[model samples]
Each structure stands twice: as structure tokens, then as C-alpha cells.
Target chain A: MSEPTSQPATQLPSRDAANWAKPVDGLKVGAISPEATNLNVEGKQLSGPLAGFGQMWQKTYRIRLSGADVTPEQVIKLWKENFPQFWPKGNRFFGGVGIEPGQVAVLNLAGPGGLNAPGGGPLISTGIMVIYADDESFSFMTPQGHMFAGMITFSAERAAETTCAQVQALVRASDPIYEIGFRLGLLKEEDRFWKYTLTALADFFGVHGAEPDLKIVLVDPKVQWAQAKNVWHNSAVRTGLYTLAAPVRWIRRLAK
Target chain B: MAPVKLDITTRKINAKTSILDIRGEVTGSAESILMAAYAEATAAGAQAIILNFGGLEYMNSSGIGLLVTMLIRIQREKQRLLAFGLSDHYRQIFDLTQLDKAIGIHPTEAAALAAAG
Candidate 1:
């Protein structure tokens, strides 16, 4: 287990650290380059007397997706129209069955703001990365929500003629609530955005596993994947720790 | 003073327990929505409360703390709190933190209501 002052992985294995919880090793991402993201946010459900605090979030979503065929402008439009739930006014934009990015929607975004958040529920700074174009992509900021700082970066390297892999990473410093969402899987709305973008790209690019919500298709070799999936997955996306090790029951079954 | 969006729905399935559909974030002033619901249920002398967690996407530490308070209130009222319609991963939180021992969490609204009755 991590000592009260020290981190886990730097000292103890993740498994051991999680079981004991003194701040096991911190999960680390590779030394990947991150670009700034621009995004707009609209805080949700704060109606009536509370509206004046302007607890509402307003901002645009920003991401820099780099690849041979992947243009930032095209991706933003597709995202706004297709997987808008992760963006502004989510409920109105996407199918009512799903959360739409909306005319200007936010997440469960319930907190009012801490001292940093405009009036004091939660504080947020939202933006996105700009590739070559400089002015495009949808993103914004808010007084409440995770993404204390949001920067979506997508860079591509030539992996193959038809299959150029991409890596997109968002650097978000989240509030404890946003952090807890990841621990609780309450951020399925956010996770869906990552899944939709990759699936849409795969469909457009004719790669393997065109499904939107599958677990391993983006990283699998069968498809023409994004060059930067890193932005799509990171601590910014989550604040707490998660584990993949099977439970003791599953481990015992495997032994059998 | 912040406005608390209060949304409550009740379906009478049996005499012992009832299901309360809650939408919106259960944080800040919004927490009163639950407190009122809990009071009303106990006043009605219901046996249990099956709080439908379908619309609630996330809960902050404050929100979680509020829930803990609700559990305490229910215990004081000689009533039970049965949470239902939770996602599997969320259900795991109850296990990971051992909250299931403190509160009754079920797979769906139906299961919660059944347990309440």
C-alpha cells in the first residue's frame, strides 16, 4: 500500500494498493503531447431562484484530431450532430432516449460551484485543441462540472496508407464529483462520446468493428483507428482509481 | 438562495412500500427534495422507500453524504431504504464500499418495490 504521503505504483502494485487504499500508486499516462481544446458548457437543472447565480454552464467543445483524412472541422460537425450528448444542450440534440449535446446542454452538472466555479458550486475551465486550421471545433467552460481544465488533443502518425492510427487525449482536472463519476460509472454520457467518435470514424474509414459501444474495437488491429485515442481516455476523463482485475469469485472460477 | 428543482413521482404498487422516481442532481438545495419525500413516506407510514435512481447520472461526495443521511433518517423512522434501477458498475460501488450492508440496493424498480413490500 502507498504510504500516507507517497503514491502507489511508484512503490506498491496497483492490486495491493487498491485493496488497502492509502493512495496506491497513481495511474499514469504516457508522455503524450496535449493540445488545447475549446468548449462551451451549459449547467443543468438549476431553475428559478437559483438561476441568477447563473449556475448555468456555457462553453464550446474543443478537440484537435490529426490524421491524413481526419479534419478537425469535419469531426466537430459530426460530433455536434451525432454524439451531441457530451457537448452543449445534450438532451435536445441527441435522441430524447439518449442525452443530446442540446441547444446548450451540460452533464448531470448539478453542483453549484466551489469558490472557483463562477458562483460557487464547482469550478471549470473548458477549451479544445486547434490543429492546423486554428478556428473551428466546438467547446466551452463552466462554473460546475469535471474538466477543471479541458484540452482535447488529437495527433496522427503514418501507420499505414489506409490505416492511420490516431490518439486523442483530453487533459481535464476534475472536481471530486466528476472524479467520483468515473469511480461510479456515472460518466457513461462522457464515455459514450469517445465510443461514438471512434465508431463514426471507423464507419467512415471502413475499418474493423464499426460498433459504437464495444470495449476493444478502437485499439484492435482490425480497424483503421484514430491516431490519438489517448485524449479519448485519461485521468481527465476520470479522477478516481479503477481496476480490471477479476474478483476473487472470477479468479476462483478461472482456476477451476 | 438557490432554486432546488424538485421532481417526484409515486406509484402505488402495494400497501407496504412505494417507489419514488427522482430526476435531477441530488446536491445542494436539491437535497431537500429527498428529505421531503422521506418525511412524506414515513408520515404515510409506509414500510419502505425504493428510491428510483434512473435519472440520477452522478452524485458528488455531498450527494453521497446526503444519501447517507437519508439512510439514517429511514432507520430512525423504523423504515427501510431500498435503492433500485442502478447500473451494474454503480452496484459495484455499493460492494466496493460495502454500502449494500447499510442500504438495500436492487437491480430494478420492480425488484426494489418487491423488497419494500
Candidate 2:
């Protein structure tokens, strides 16, 4: 693996610097919709692939808008502006009007088969921080209690004649319980979720019947046993307990 | 601006250490090349791998994802990954993504080699 001593002398560009989010110790959710619950998101540190317990996986879902005469930038513009609208029926993403760097968005995700909590909230309440964003692509990093520990990038690219919208996630189950769920077919649910989003996106561009291409790769098969303790901060468990305690809070409010 | 395709060259600095000089932008397209370079370094029995990002012009979020993928591979092989020559902007990207916690970042190539030692 030896190479000659010739190295390029190119002056690097720094234009993308402003596109990245500045460092923050923890995430803080801004104003969100009343429909979204902001539990398990505030003051949480971001978790990356290294902080996960399960085997790491990289999945890419893409759909080509063949009939739509839109550029990559145009696709990204609509995708970022109306990000949550493209989600599958039950999931909800509550963020600001537009996606940008350093933005924090809360998510209310349905359990299998679109199950909701007794309090009419989605089963899992987690969030993501927008770590990077640009015209062509934007990426979100999961918070500590999210289902997965890692980053997901949504991008649009000019592929030959058509524009291809892609969602790529490099993630691992955040804790043991989630790891078990992933092993027991939650992975397929995740696949269906993103693929549905892509199909919706294509439909939004007037291109119907678009089939999404899926690719899954096992990046690392070893699970980090040290991260098993992450289950303590699992959002699903916390959300369930919070829902169960809702009546106590209502009683306290009545007393006050 | 025209996109600069990623170019990588690997060189063994010592019996246990190898360095990959990364040039141009790192995006989804750079995956195969980057992985091939890492494979070469590991095939040479390198216990520590150093990344020289002096010539790197741009890297997006997908590029950051690639580094995480590479980090997983390095950890599986029980090898150390160190980097230097990152611009201040790129350094901040590492910090924001929390990749600095996993990969050691040094001020210079000599510093990275010393850390590898």
C-alpha cells in the first residue's frame, strides 16, 4: 500500500462551513405543533453509531421521479419545506416551518400497525437535531433516547435525465430492547416507512407508481455490549410511563 | 463549482502504521474508493491508520456517514484511526457529529503519528 511522494496542492474551499450546525452540548426543542408531544427530547445529547448497542446497518432508499421535470434543488426545496407531510399515515414530525442547520425536531412515531398510546400520542416520542443542511441534501442526528443511534441523510441528485431522491441511514439500535425489536422485524417496518415516504414524495411531484429501490448493508456485525445501559434512557419506556402517569398530573392540576 | 472527485493514496509509515492521503470531496460516490483504501491499509497489517485531510476540499453529511462506517470497520479490526490536516470548518463538523469522540484528531501528521505510537 505504498504510494509515491506526489501530493496535490489544491486550495480547499470553505463554502460549506455555514451549512453545518454549530456545536451544542445538548438539544433543545423549539416551538412545536400542539399535535406533537415533546417528551424525551429536551436536554438530550446526540448519539451516533459508536454509542449504539446493536449491530450497525446502512440502509439506502431511493426513488426516481422520471416523469416530473424537476431539478435536484427543486426536489430538496419541497422535501425540506414539507418534510413531515410525506411521512407514513401515523408518524408525525413537528419542527419549524423549514429545515435548517441546528434545528431540533420532535417525532411522534407509531408502534407496529400504527398503534397509539392511551393518551392519543404516538408510541415513541423522540427527536433529531439537524446537524447539516444544504440545497441538495440535509442530515439529522438522533438524540440520546431515540430508537436508533446515528445519522440519516436525505438527498436529491441529478441522475442522468431524472432526479433521484434518497434517504440513507447509518444507524444501530440505541439499546438492547430496541435491538430485540429490530431483530424481530422492526427493521422491515422501518423499511416500509421510508419507502412509503419516498413514494409519497414522488407522488407529490406528479409522478405516481414510483417504486423505491432499497439497499441494506451490515456495516458492523458486532454489538457494543457496553451500550446496553442505554436502555435506561429508552424513549419508548419513558413515553409509556409518562402516559400512564397522565391522570396523576391531571389530578394535581385540579388540586392547584 | 465543479465537483472534485475523491482521490486516495495509501502509504505505510512504519511496520504498524499506515497513512491515507485523502484529496477532493467525500460524498456517497467516494464509498468504494475509501473502503478500498482502508482495505489496503488493513491488508498490510497496519495496527494504526492515519487520515491526512490536507487536500480535502468538501465533505457533506453523507461523507460524515462514510467516516462512521469506516470507524466501525477499523474498530472491528482492533486498529486505531487518527486524523490531521482538517480545516477549522471540517473540525467543527467532526465536533457537531460527535465523531471526534471516536476518532483522535491531532494538529499535524507528526502529532497523529505520535498518538498512533
Candidate 3:
């Protein structure tokens, strides 16, 4: 869509790629960065997961669930509905990077996959993604900020009649030109993930009299996955990023 | 000057692999800390390395970008680099941004280290 923001000194992986498909419970992720950290702010800049930003932010999570029967498709569906919420710029999509027609899908909200606001704080991902489903492998540009951000992979193995979905999402980001999403786990703002996930588990099972032993390793922007989500039938007091107060204040502040 | 604390601690999973635990904010001077750690590991002749995000708290774009740089370098050296411990939010960011295609990530450091070796 946009011309190369900066001349990427760091080259790309030299191989062909394949598209991703939903599969089992496997997780893999890593980064690709630029040789230089500073971007020409006068020129365009980018950041977020799908981006190849050099340095802005990162968090990691690994989840394991064992039950009567589980399938990767079920997990992938849950992932698509719930997972997309955590993506950058809140739910928008650029079908495939070029300025091709029907390429951009601008989401109007903040908590999913599109920008939280119009002209500030929100991030833009810029990079190239090369996926290889046949080889059970994939790759893309890191430091996705100045170019593109995000890529998906899925691998499934059906043991008997059940399937475990093995998946990975990678990001290479850069600090945004705008100061939208940044927090320091301030004021024990870090403690909410445990409270949320545990409470959710208790309430869902208590209220519905239905028990799903879901162990979620939440790699919170602030807290550890040792606790957080599904288990907590609790309010999303804050988005995945932890906070003591409601984020309305922050969002309001961002708007102002 | 503050130490610009960039700590890279490695544990040998076996002969051909080491899991490098990178913590602290990968911003400002710390960015270089990660860079140095990666470079040293590559030079140390480790066949494969797993980057453990379990200990890290926050990382910005520059931080992620720097890792990509490390990935390219590692590939050149014929070494394998994998990642573990990323959260759902960060995972979505990477997925949408396509970072998954850049480096290898495993559910655990053991798998990543083992894959490269």
C-alpha cells in the first residue's frame, strides 16, 4: 500500500512460504528486528504484532489443556472469536498489504483488531509474511512496525478421534510514532490477571454447574500466564494489558 | 550510567542446545543487551537457542524489531532460534503482523532448544 517507509537494511528469509490453516494446541513465536532502532519519524512509522517493528513491546503465553476430548477446530474457533480481540488496532484488516481494492477493513472499536482511536496511540503493522503449511513451518518479516505485522500457523494431529492444535503467532514491532499503548504494571496493576482468570473459572462452574478444567497460561502484557482468562468469569476490567482502574479513564485520556 | 541491565542467562538443555532467559525491559540500552546476548550465543557456537519470554515483562516495537535482526543473524550462522512464553495479546499482535513466520517458537523452551539441535 505505502511505499517502503525506510530502506530495510536487514534482509528477509530466502525461501518460499505457505498459507496457514487451523490445527492443534502448539505455540511458537519469535521476532525479527532492524539493524538500526531509530526510524525517520518525519517519514511514516509503524508498530504492533503483525508489524516488523524494531522495539516497542512483547509478551508470551503458553497454554496446555487435557480433557475428555478436544479438537483443534474448536480451539481455533475459540481463538478466532476471542483471540482477535487481543490484536492491534482493534479488528481491522488489510486483506493483503498492497493498496489493492477491498484490501483494508477498518474496524471501529478498540478492544479487538483495530486502532483504539483515529490519529493517536494506536499502532500500524508493516511487514511481509511467508507461511508454509505443508512443511508445518512458517516465517515473516520482523520489526513489523514500519512495514507489516502478524502471521498465523496451525498444525494438527488426530490421535484416535481427537486433535491437538499446534499454532504460532509472530511479531516484529517498533515503538509507535504516537504514544497509545504503554504501561508499567504500575501500582500492582499487575495483580489482576490472576484475580480475573481464577474468578472466571469459579463463577462459570459455580453458576452453570458446568465444570471445564481450563488451564490458561496468560502471557499478560503485565502479568504471567500462570493465571488469567477462561477460568475467570470476571469482568474484563482492562484489556489483556493489566490495570487497577477501568481503562475508560485511559481511553478518555487518549481521546483528549 | 545505570547498568542498562541486559541480562542473558543460558541453560544447556543438552549438548546442542541452550535456553536463554531474557528479562528486563528491552528498551533503550536494554535493547543492546538483548543484541549482545544473541550475538554472543551465536558466536559461542551454540547449535540452537531458545529464548524464554517467561521472565520478560514488557517489550516495545524496537524490542521486537531487534529480535528480528537477531533472527536474521542467527540464520546466517546456521544456528536455530526459537521463542516461548508469549501471551495471547502479544500472540495476536504477532499473528496479525506475521511474526510467526520469522523465527521458530515452541510451546516450551525445551522443544525449541531441541528443535534446533
**Top-DockQ candidate index:** 2
Residue A159, model 1: Cα distance from true site in angstroms: 54
Model 2 chain A: weakest 10-residue lDDT segment is: A2-11
What tens digits encode model 1's per-residue C-alpha lDDT throughout A43-132?
211111111111111111222222336544454344444543332221122122211111222232222211222232112222211111
Top-scoring candidate (TM-score): 2
TM-score of chain B of each: 0.82, 0.95, 0.80
Task: Give the per-residue lDDT of model 2 (tens digit) for A1-256.
Answer: 4543332344455868878898889899999988788898999999987889999999999999997999899999999999999998788999998899999999999976678898787889999999989999999999998999999999999877889999999999999999999999999999999999999999999999989999999999989999999999999999999899999999999999
Measured against the true structure, the TM-scores of the candidates, in listed sequence, are 0.32, 0.94, 0.34
Candidates sorted on TM-score, descending = 2, 3, 1
RMSD of each: 22.4, 2.7, 17.9
Relative to the real complex, the DockQ score for model 2 comes to 0.51
| Highest-lDDT candidate | 2
Question: Model 1, range B6-69, lDDT digits (tens) per residue?
Answer: 5766644456666677765554356677877776766666788878766554432234435655
What is candidate 2's TM-score for chain A? 0.94
- Model 3 alpha-carbon miss at residue B101, Å: 1.5
